[model samples]
Target chain A: MNTLKINYKNIYYPPGGILMWIIIFLELITFGMALVAFVYYGNEQRELFHHSRMQLNTTFGAINTVFLLTSGFFMANAVHQFKEKEIQKSSVFFKLAMLGGFLFLGLKSIEYYHKIESGISLDTNMFYTFYWLLTGFHVIHVIMGLVILGWTNYGMTKKDSDTITEDVEACAAFWHMCDLIWLLLFPVLYLIF
Target chain B: MQKSLIFVYGVLIALTIATALIANFMLVSPFVVSLIMGLAVFKFSLVTFQFMELKKANSFWKVSLTLTLGLIVLLIIFLK
Candidate 1:
């Protein structure tokens, strides 16, 4: 019988999957602060806060949700491919996931452009402040995920497959974090009042 | 396993669209809307647990990660 080695301490250590745990922890802290700001500001101007929500395109938010979810699926498939020792197949999925991230940014840019044209700038009011701050932070993470995905694909082409699996795994984890954070953000920022 | 997960993925996407439409179009109470939105969170958790196989991971890690996410949600609720 072949026995798999298990190390308990490794489960909670840095550079292990616990790196994701740390990143997630930081994200939760920042998002929590943002929520507090939103509530505080919303209370100061309740009508404007709700009215700003009415201007947002729920359709755009819905489409972005679909895009991020699909990207998460591709990232999962990429990890599966790596587990199967199909390096090229895994790289393809990583690139596809990055493409999804790019598509999301494009949609978001369009949404912002329309908002600006309609005179709903970030300086418009407190709600717009939260809208821009939360979603803008989210877009930064999306771009970072895409950059990580691109670098992972490049590393796959340049290095031995076994040498890069850990990095690829880390990048996939980050990309999925990006997706998961958006899942939370979409409901709070776009769906709810 | 992967194919079935993909099917579940499709169902999740459909649920998001359905929930968004209901939230936007219906005249439901905020409490009822939150209930529906909570259902979406359940479906999302199902995908992460079943499709992503997080349930099969080391139990300690999964539990800690879940606790962290719960804390985030609790903070959001703190505002209301």
Candidate 2:
């Protein structure tokens, strides 16, 4: 007990493992830099930016925001439940979380469809360029997140799954990273001009 | 933990509604833009601290995430 307490207090390992955290920080830097560049171009093409903003549907964006928030909420619950050794419950929560991700993808794909139909391709303008590249990159991450969550779910079903707690936590961290990036993207791409 | 998770979800959803309303109803201005971005930062921190459990993370993780969001928001606001 004393050793455990000392380790907890002194060493302070991050949740979801250190490697995942490193990946997260790197991902954040990449997305942050892209957004900064987008802002720089936004300043140059103010009118174009405004027009692109008008083209987006904030209602769809808000719905997707809810989808991600709810998904992250479920993923966090899954992590907590797994820690408590409630494997069944945790698996359920993770599935719900995956459902949320799919919903987000569905809505976002609809938005992309509208853009493509209206002749708003990647080269439509500077704002559209950032919109396609940044948000498209984010869409890929969402798809990847689904794969991670599914893998974690598979891990939960196997014998000795409890021993792979770090994998579960790492997957949760990645899903939440997707959630976090969308929190940034929804505002920049949908709400703010 | 469950209660706090629920509370965070509530706040995040409410903030989403608020973002939509402001965009649809309010007059567009720099202040409005900043407000939208501010709300985005708030939502981002909520997910990071609550879902990511960064609140319990080491100081370095906490500071790093905060500074990353800070840099992006500042660049967006000032650069434009």
Candidate 3:
């Protein structure tokens, strides 16, 4: 039993849990399926897609991409620091990560405001339909990730290293999912034109 | 962990800039869209392998996730 215990300590398993991977798998398929549908429709209406795509502001999308990537970077660092037994440093990095998320949301809101003010509603066109659904869905995930990160930040204040580790790892996984989804979306919606 | 993760992020940020430049400044070309989408796939790999800590996980995990990403990229390419 003692030998088994010592061996278990050295094994590096995935952070978070296996079920989170399952969820990630499912979530990615759902988005991919949706994107495929978008691509099909866009291909059928290539001219319309081209016209509507021009209405979008790549500048905002590019900036938001940076925001999310920076957030993901900080989140990875947060997990690393947490593993190193630096609770205070981990919390600081997590806060910075959250700040990036919030900034992305703020900029996204502005982008939405401009789109709405320009009279571009969800029903404006087929391309807009996919745009609202895909990006709005992503925004919801970002919100959910922020909430989880908030709880993870609170967990770091406690003295229990074991639970803190799990919380941080799980939070990092979820946040990175957000980043990954955005990577797919940015190229499809903003960069394809 | 810190140094390697930082390096991954640096590469990712640089790729982000490259994608933007290619998409915005480059004129219309048959291969442009393919290149942009390819960068997305590369970025996805970095995020999965480095940030998601899949690099330390079992091979089964890495392979399955990569296959899934590949399938998605293929679907996009077919339509593009």
Candidate 4:
């Protein structure tokens, strides 16, 4: 019987690996600074921000939030099942996670289509500049996350597979980073002004 | 473990809906923004600790993540 081993006491070996955590921190900080800048500019042009924010669809944003959070839940479960040596169950969860990601992208694409059709662009206004840049960047991350999950899922389910707990954990950490970033972005972009 | 994961998922979905409702139905104001952001922060912590498995991580990682989130939230509130 194979069992996963991790040193919880070791700061250098946090869950999903130290390197992944470092990347997570760096990503968080990068997004955090952008959010701060968004708020600063939002305050500078209060009416513009408010009016532009009104143009956004909170319903789509809210639905996307649910999508990503549910995806993150499936991802965590995938990792948990992997650790339990339930490879088939883990694969099923991985597929479900990817499905959630796809649904988010689908909804986001529809939203983006509406915005573009309405002639909203990055140069539209202060509020929209932040909107396009932040949400566009986040969409790229979701696409990348889906790709990673695809590769990881393939590796885990293939014949003579060598996928390990660390691999799934690292993939999950990356996916959840997308969730975390959206958690920050959704409120600031779609809800709060 | 499955039970706990489902519980967390339910809480996350509930909070997401609550935040959206507060933002949509209520008038936009500093107080409303604060409440919404507060819920965002709480949801953020839930995902970080529970979904990301940071709960099982070193105290250093946990504290650093929490502090970073706090700083970001403070900045948003203060600047907004």
Candidate 5:
């Protein structure tokens, strides 16, 4: 009879191993959907899909890839510093990674603005549809990373090392996952065209 | 300061610049672009596994991640 009465927050707070599994599950689903879109495009109108892909701005894709890889490096540094018990330096790296995420969002928005100005949009065609869906979904994850980093920053100022270390590791894992996804995406979406 | 770390960083930066130039000016063949991208992935894996100390992570976690990547790559090939 477990009567310790854990709070709702405790159940939800990440770095709880269960939450990592849940995040992995969600990632698998997104990856599956993207795969399905690719297959569908393959069967229906392959040439149109290839033609539409050329309309994408590869320069922006390359820039975003660089930004994501930089963010992952900072995140790795943050976790490394956390293990070293240098909380202040870890926090700095975390903030740097967060800044990288913001820079990515800024570049993505600029790309989107030009896209919209050129009269292209989500529903314009299958290629644009997958383009917006996949990239937009990634942007949402980047925003979530920012929010988590903001909270982790607050924790860094107040919490003990063990707690903060856990948070930093979890966020680093998520950030690295973001970086990995973009690695695949950059080649598939941009270079392939 | 480990020389290996510095050497790895130098290679990563060089590869990055090279990839950008190839994408922009050279317009290399798709196979070469993929080769460059694959190298980038390898670089990042080294950074994550060795530099970040994930090399000793639980086997289950590593296997799962690798499987996910494999599946995703297969799907992308089918797309092409």
Candidate 6:
């Protein structure tokens, strides 16, 4: 008689582990609630929201979306390479992912500069308030993700590298969270009123 | 696996472009808004299931995330 063996880790722990999944869930819920509120207020002041949204550059938003998505793809590839034991290739992909993050920040900074030059701030209006708060928080997340990726890449470079699969998976998960949040934010803030 | 990843990425980019075109060129209507939101949800799912490897995860995570996204989209549409 053959007994089936179960890998409990596969059953309970996700790609990045249980703890990271918890963080992702909480973050998603928080952002979802904020988006719902933004929509509610948008309905209340339709014209203001429309006008405020018009102040945004859709091209920049679209480009940024591409940036994050590309970065996410690269990060996924990095994890794949790492799992395949191609550490050098994984590091290259990691760098590419970081490049995407940097491009996103660069474009976002330009957009922010334009807004600040035009005297737009968190208190500018309800729409701008949501804009700043939501996107600003997201930018912070991207920055944190980049730092995590950078550290993970550095670890990969050491002769006796101690970077484990779980650590790399956690980093990728966090980076993808940034991508996921931006995916939600880009449309509501840029395309929709 | 790499081919599959590439396919997913292609689909995502195409969807993103379609969304932009619809929003920029088409007249604003209930249908248009719904379409854009729907596309956004589709893109989100691709990233979550494919890039984030949620497809390999347990059913609980998959179901809960799907429900969470659905709820968020419904609330936005209802409120809007």
In order of listing, the candidates' clash counts read 0, 0, 0, 0, 0, 0
DockQ of each: 0.40, 0.69, 0.59, 0.82, 0.20, 0.66
User: What lDDT score goes with residue A192 in model 5?
Assistant: 54
Candidate 3, RMSD to the unseen true structure? 3.2
lDDT string, candidate 4, B1-80, tens digits: 49999999999999998998899799888899899999999998999889888888889999999899899989999898
Would candidate 5 be rated incorrect, acceptable, medium or high by CAPRI criteria? incorrect
What are the Cα lDDT values of the candidates?
0.72, 0.85, 0.86, 0.92, 0.67, 0.91
Candidate with maximal lDDT: 4
Models sorted by TM-score, best on top: 4, 6, 2, 3, 1, 5
Of models 1 and 6, which has the larger TM-score?
6
Structure candidate 4, residue pairs in collision: none
Question: How do all models score by TM-score?
Answer: 0.86, 0.93, 0.93, 0.98, 0.80, 0.96
Give the C-alpha miss distance for residue A91 in model 6, angstroms: 0.3
lDDT of 1 at B73: 63
| The best candidate in terms of TM-score | 4
Per-model chain B TM-scores are: 0.66, 0.95, 0.90, 0.95, 0.66, 0.96
Model 3 chain A poorest 10 in a row by lDDT: A1-10
Q: How accurate is candidate 3 locally (lDDT)?
A: 0.86
RMSD of each candidate relative to the true structure: 3.2, 2.5, 3.2, 1.0, 6.4, 3.3
Please report the interface RMSD of model 5 to 1 decimal.
Answer: 6.5
Give the backbone clash total of model 4.
Answer: 0
Q: Given candidate 2, what's the lDDT at residue A180?
A: 85
In model 2, the clashing pairs are none
For candidate 6 chain B, the 10 contiguous residues with the lowest summed lDDT are: B27-36
* Candidate 2 lDDT, B19-80, residue by residue in tens: 88998898777899899999999999998888887887778878887897898888887876
* Ten-residue stretch with the least lDDT total in model 4 chain A: A1-10
- Candidate 3 vs candidate 6, TM-score winner: 6
TM-score of the first chain of model 6: 0.95
Residues A1-193 of candidate 4: C-alpha lDDT, one tens digit per residue: 6778888658987888889899999999999999999999999998999899999999999999999999999999999999999999999999999999999999999999999999999899988988999998999999999999999999999999999888989999999999999999999988887
